[model samples]
Target: MMHTSVGWHVEMEFREDDQHTRAVAMVRLPDGSEVRAHGHASRHQTDVNQPRVGEEIAAARALNELAMQLLTKAHGEIDQASGRTSHPIHV
Candidate 1:
């Protein structure tokens, strides 16, 4: 059995206000490239105050965007090396 492990570290930052939350997520690839994505959440005027919920929503959106970006990057790299366009499966 192979005992080797690989890891990646992602960083996220948030800027929040009473009615809004914005998040940015970033990760550095082993090839020395950095990818970043942003997300935002806004509370409705009638919504109750919930900072934690806002943070969670914003963070999840940011992470989702980051994942999409990474997939796009990898897909481009594959196309470049393979010399053919490959269709992507929708998630």
Candidate 2:
């Protein structure tokens, strides 16, 4: 049996104000490539102020986008290696 171990670390940063929250999510691949995604959340005029909720929403969106990007990248690589179009990859 052959065994291999790999690990990836993701970094997330957020910026928030009274009405808006912005988040950036990044991951560094083993092949010396970096992928990043951004997300934003806006507070409604009548909504309660909850910084944590805003941050969570923004971060989740950013991470979701990042996952989609990674999947797309893998799909492209698979197609390139196989020399044919592959099935669609979804989040």
Please give the RMSD to the true structure for each candidate, in Å.
1.5, 1.1
Please provide TM-scores, in order, for all candidate models, with all chains considered together. Answer: 0.92, 0.93
Tell me the lDDT of candidate 2: 0.94
Per-residue alpha-carbon lDDT of model 1 for 1-91, expressed as tens digits? 8897777899999999999999999999889999999999999989999989999999999999999998888889999999998776648
The per-prediction tally of clashing pairs is: 0, 0
Top-lDDT structure, candidate number: 2
**C-alpha displacement of 68 in model 2, angstroms?**
0.8
Write out the backbone clash pairs for model 2.
Answer: none
lDDT of 2 at 37: 99
Cα error of candidate 1 at position 74, Å: 0.4
Model 2: per-residue Cα lDDT over 1-91, one tens digit each: 9999999999999999999999999999999999999989999989999999999999999999999899889989999999998887563
Runs of candidate 1 with Cα error greater than 4 angstroms are 1-3
